[model samples]
Target: MSLIYPPLQAPKRLLFGPGPSMVAPRVYQAMTQNVVGHLDPFFFQVADEIRSLLGYAYSTSNQFNLAISGTGSSGMEAAVANFTEPGMKFALLTNGFFGDRLGEMARRQGGEVVRLAKPWGEPYDPQEGREFILRERPQVVAFVQAETSTGMFNQAKPICEAAHEVDALTIADCVTSLGGMPVLVDENGIDIAYSCTQKGLGCPPGLAPMTVSPRALDRLKARKTPVQSWYLDLQLLDTFYTGHKYHHTASATLFYALREGLAMVAEEGRENRWQRHQRNHQAFVAGIEAMGLGMHVQNPAGRLWTLNTPRVPEGVDDAKVRAWLLEKRGIEIAGGFGPLAGKVFRIGLMGHGSTEDNVALILEALADALKA
Candidate 1:
């Protein structure tokens, strides 16, 4: 077959999907600047500034905060591979797909995985997990703070408390939670937490911002055997992220973009940014209910501020409606994952995408798509 060139310009999309919410203009501008060597003095300063912002974003004073040169899933792998050894018991609280994925990755690294599960659209109960952990007594308890699959926000305080009661380290997936809502990693007693740039941070995906608490760091240093994944090994990464030992080359351009994004976040102010998402969610929920659509997670308090999973109305093809909205209105949403697929539509109100105009536009487009 002859080679074919694609269109010169891509279609303009209003991203209101699972992640990769709309990017701020400054972040976009940052990426278009002239490139610099990864180890250039100015780029090194930029990287250090990004790390400081990551510390603030994660709401921790951790000295080990830094961005991995990969997606959020890579951050999960790094967390698991660093703290877990072969044949050691690791506990997971699985309420959605990502939580289960964490358990799977841990198992692949030779962890004896034990899962505590709830239904697909429900949140895992920390009290129940506490009882199970007391019995299983795993070395680590891992879970997703915001279960993106079902739009359920897993409350971390009680879960972290439960895990600590059993003397297990806590690893939280804050991929969808970091910027939209309050993470409070230090106050919540989370041993390790990982997030991505694309979701609430309002930047294109590239960096996995993570923080490992001092306790978790100590556990890694005390591990009986060396971690298996060399690329994701915490020992080498720690030297670079914590001690500035320069372990591997990092992308200076993406760090520039990330720095710009974090600056935007600071300008908005964390509390105000969080309030914007919550207010937008409330407005959207009201609009969706007015259109007779039910939410998948009935408890409003348990719903995620960043991602909303609304039940697909009866007699509607979920994917068909999504396609209609995208084709006709340039709006993009997501369908549910795993067992929740086709049952709900996932709408994101995050970062720069979380605005009254975007919310209204999406609701109007969804209404039109449903009627057609």
Candidate 2:
């Protein structure tokens, strides 16, 4: 029997989950612009604009910055596969799911993995990983600046400082922090940083905005071995983006969306954007506390402004509450992952999605769900 369906449509949802936050109407309109060929000069103009805007979004002056034609995981894998060779020691300071992901990718790249592990919800003190870096002297040191799974924010400065003392390159997972909070790529001395266009950037999921410092670019150039993945090879990709020597069929449609989103970021000003996210986050936290719920990240300073993890109340099924919120309120929030599964809810307040009214709306819906 053939299946029947109504006209294709997406259900209206208020995205309060970990990523792919609510896209602004401006970005949506940009997506509707004429799709140009990747080689078209108009496409290149948009691509060039995206490159410069990525610098501003990431707070970096690095020239080797561009959006990878894949998601955040692609960016993570590229960073690992390009930097580490066989038998090279790779130190991963992991406190959450994304950090562990980096370690696994490095190991697959033949990196000698020594992961400094911690519980899921705990934030990292940059000093805690200093001794590990000092002892290992790994060629590549990687960490997640924003632990998306647990709403914990990790500082990169001291880790970068310690890694530099040993001449080690640093890779920061800025997927959750970029555009929502401060990544401070230049100030923290991060060698390589990667993030998704979703979440903090107030765009849909498609591209991973990545940047490499001059030092990291130099390391990449001097590497004896060919980069494992041809598609993710930054040098070849750079030729396509900068030299306009078509290496792949680039998505000019997504470029339009990103260009407009970054333009919004530029107009808002980076500091103002950070403050806006933080302010909404605080309001959400206060409302949650008033509802008798506690946050998973106990340390207030380390809590992320983009993603918030609220602890599941005693005797409450996190899944049911999430389901109720979705079915009854038309709101979408996320549940915890890995070790913290069933323990917390992941609420994302990112980019244009982070607002006073959203905080109020989600809080009200959450309170009703809990009561139900």
Candidate 3:
């Protein structure tokens, strides 16, 4: 006889981790809508609307805005693979794990990588970045706007200006910032910006929303060598999204989820949503400090409102605390990694999860766990 297993049933989790934050009920409902063909006219209409909403979310007027049919990492790869050519110089600003990953992607694309290193849990100096860009004169400069690993928020305007000064394209990893904070791609002069459907968008994973400025498109058009990744090639992908051409079998359900999530963002208004994240972050910080815990990001201005990294108490085991919270309270919080492993806990308050009730609940649970 075949072994029997229960039907798929997932518990209700209060997601307080770095990503895949709590999805809104409406978004879940939308995902259950009837599936449609990738090339169906109605699905194409959904794709078009997503492009416009993504433009609003990113605060950009770039014409190349579209959602890649993968996670945020796919967006990262697309940004690097399309812009980087063999022997082309690429300057990467490394202040955390994601920045280092960008540098690695650039290197794999055959670009000569020049990493501008900064300590984790710190932000980069604009002047230093400008000077580095001028000295290196790399063809592309990339940085993470929100460093989720250490909860550091990087300033984009200075970095973009610096890259533009030397005619280098700017690529911003807005994975943890978009929808939760002000990306303002046009105002910041970012040539390319990429984010995911999860996190601040309050949607499921599998969609990477991205936009590319005209300057970056011009450079891509002028490139002598073809882009390496066929699946992520912008030239081919554009035809499918922009024109009535077929590229791949895009998931209609994921698009439905993203569209509903974007609708929620629009309903709340961007500024209001950002302020909500900020307020919750402040409250969380106050609670953490009151419990005698410290934050990983020392500089107030460098702190990411979406992802807060609180230092693990000296005597407590980080894993034990996280496990206890999950088992006893059904709360899902993540521990830090890389240099911050066993040193800090990453608690995210983003999108629908960025609420007063959730903040209070997490803080109470954390305090109890610490005391235990």
Candidate 4:
């Protein structure tokens, strides 16, 4: 086979990385269905169903919820760009990589960005975050509800409340939280939140499921300047998804997969699904502890249930272990990055990938890899 066009055969690996997690069989089947035009009536019906289903996934009734055509970062950019304009003061709470990405997006949009920085793998103190928001008094505030790089879950309620108190619109990066845990957009007062299908939603990576509160939407529509990215403009997306107008060629195959994945979420029941992920995470942690390995996050409550980060033992090479799992065991997992590089292993038990058997398999394989 040519190097550029290699053979289609691929090795099967148990995905335990941070994202692009194992997809459900049902979602795969759904993708094999007939393809329809982006503007087809049937496609519109599917789109409508997806938006409605996304409401259940995001735990909101904001009426402006829809999937962005790009990945989770795209949704993050959309959320940042739509509400923030030139000269606006934007406050970012950064504890991990994605939080910094938000600040970058805002800066690119010509917003004045100020940030409160914390060590990676540590969730911010709610009071400290609130104080920063109030002190900065930014027009827009953004934070990561679930930090993918470090497996930390920051509290959205306090952050959202503080933003509102300062009359700032809030954006939450829920890329790793949406399906595996409780986002509680309405209850948490999250004005805007976005997630990826590949992580908690058990679908492939293409769509970014997003929700925007009326407050944020109003601010977006009444912006003094046009949104920076035309492709990610919420107003245009609103017309495309809700108004049935031609904007872009959205993938019906991907939409089919998303709709089916979301339907599975509905069938499994949101609360029930969250419980399942929680149980699997606890079990996995117990197994890791039993193996004399420690977790990356000190506070158990702040750690992510969907994505777990375990401390790498002294004298053991993290990359070698991950390589062994891939070459010898055909299991795919991830190593830590940034300040966490070579110090932790980033393992995911998200969406369809979360299960007792999978947990046991990883533990056994990792133990063997360590022994090897």
Candidate 5:
């Protein structure tokens, strides 16, 4: 017997999860536009627009900026693999899952990885980080600027200064921070940074927004060995993004979506967008606390405005509450992972999805779900 494949129709959902926050309507509409060849002049214009917007969103003046055709992990691996070589020492500040993953990726690339581990939900202190750096004297120091898993924000300035003082390259994971907060990569002295389009960019997940400072680019230029991951090698990828011809099959449709998304971001204005997210986050916290729920991250200033993790009330099964929210209310909130598993629920207020109404709706549903 032959079976027929069905057409697609996605259910309407209010996404308040760790990633894949709701795509702006404009971005969604752009995805449905006419598809063009990747090499077309118009497509190159789209690429140019995307690079400019990414630089603005990331608050960077770096000449090297591109969106890789993959998720945030792809960007992370690309940054580490291209710049770090075998037998080189690298220090990783691990307080959450993504930080550990970066460390693992660095090790896999044959870099000697040393950890300056901190408790989850706590940002690493710059002085302590410096002490570790001085002890390890690593060639590179990496940390997550926004620890999504634990709802902690690592202030990039001090950490970058400490790394730079010791002559180590600074790599930051802004996967959950970009477009939500001021990254100010050039001002903060970040050598390399990577973000995901799905989180704060109000776009779907396929693209990894990445940028490298002139210093990091210099390292790539001076590398004695080829990058282990040929597909992610920045030297060749630069050729495709620059004057040289295409090196791989680029996604024209997604590029269109990204261009439209960046346009919406420009319309909203970056500073205004950041303030909007902060406002919604404050309101969400107020509503949740008013309902007697506690926040996981102690310092309000250190909490990630885009991704909020609230402590799950006692006797409330996170799985059950999450299921009720999705199946019954059509609202999606994420459960904790790694060290935070079953302890807190991650609620994202990001990009176009960060709104007063959305926050209140999620809180109301959450209160009811908790009572049930």
Candidate 6:
């Protein structure tokens, strides 16, 4: 007996959701290149180039920078697991979902979690974060530089400074900001920073590009207990990346895609790419305001260039609007989470997806959806 399956035909969508943004044609082409064994010499050369490019992307000189063989969440887990131990004090600055997730990961690692929370869609004041860090005296301080859940961008420099004052390591989640904005891991004093390839890098979601400062690496080296996650252990990963040891099988295809994406970033110039995102974001905001819609993030400084959360109009059906956009226009925008549910639309303009054309199209489609 023979079984028949339908041919895979995925819809061509203008992804304006929180993540997995549109990939560049170059990245797709890179993925189609011939695969190599994870431990092959040729693969090692690819890995070396990726590490170098990742450092450029992260704006860091740290030799520990490399792409973890998992999604953004894996990078989160790795950062937490390596730096935390039982009964350690971990201070998390939270205002949205991803911040809360860092707290959860810390707790799972037996960290005595201390959370300093601000209202959703708001950025934490640097002074307040400093006070919290001093008061909590945590061994590790974690926060999201770009809060994807709320479309807010937090000030990282002051937070890192405060953490350092307390002799604490700072972990920054740059998943949404790395390629789109200036993460400046070294300048901001971030000890460990992790990001995803899909959102800002214009690649498929698979690799998590991460960097660890010397201070963070020293802390990891001095850990009393073994890292909880065997696969995500940084020491083991470091050995693998440094010594060409076989710790695990990493896909060469994904590495190819990541390299190609990073190459694009380098070619465009990081600052120029950031300005492009900012320009597109400003255009989107202007269009939304013209349509009589308000933004969810009130503070101009708090707003993220890549992710935009426009308030759902009063008496308008949020789900219906999202559905109509998807069904009629083939555009995919997301709804809010937790306290923000049904109150706002989470639209992303990231990487190759961030364009003047997309901004205009989405605005027009959104206007039509609202009217219908």
In candidate 1, list every pair of residues with a backbone clash.
none
Give candidate 2's total backbone clashes. 0
TM-score of each: 0.96, 0.98, 0.98, 0.98, 0.98, 0.98
lDDT of 4 by residue, 129-222 (tens): 8899999999998999999999899989999999999999889999999999999999999999999999998999999999999988888878
- Please provide, for model 3 over 1-372, each residue's C-alpha lDDT reduced to its tens digit, 9 standing for 90 to 100: 698988999998989999889999999999889999999999999998888888889988987888899999999999999999999999999899999999999999999999899988877778888899999999999999998899999999998898888999999999999999999999999999999988999998999999999989999899899999999998889998778799988899999999998888888899899999999999999999998899999987789999999999888899999999999999899998988899999999998899999989999999998877
Clashing residue pairs, backbone N/CA/C < 3 A, model 4: none
Q: Give the C-alpha miss distance for residue 323 in model 4, angstroms.
A: 0.3
* Deviation (Å) of 112 in candidate 5: 0.3
Per-residue lDDT of 1-372 in model 2, one digit per residue for the tens? 598887999999999999889999999998888888999999888888988999998999998889999989999988998899988999999999999999999989999999888899786666678998999899999999999999999889999999999999999999999999999999999999999988988889998899999999999999989998999999999997769999888787788888888999999999999999999999999999998899999999999999999999999999999999999998899999789989999999998899999999999899999999
lDDT against the true structure, per candidate, is 0.88, 0.92, 0.92, 0.92, 0.88, 0.92
Give the worst 10-residue stretch by lDDT in candidate 5.
240-249
Q: Write down the TM-score for model 4.
A: 0.98
Error of 6 at 282 (Å): 0.6
lDDT for 68 (candidate 1): 86
Task: Point out where model 1 deviates above 4 Å.
Answer: 1-8
Query: Which regions of candidate 6 deviate over 4 angstroms?
Result: none
Stretches off by above 4 angstroms in model 5 are: none
Residue 60 of model 1, lDDT score: 90
Shift of residue 166 alpha carbon in model 1, Å: 2.1
Clashing pairs in 3: none
What residue runs in model 4 are displaced by over 4 Å at the alpha carbon?
1-7
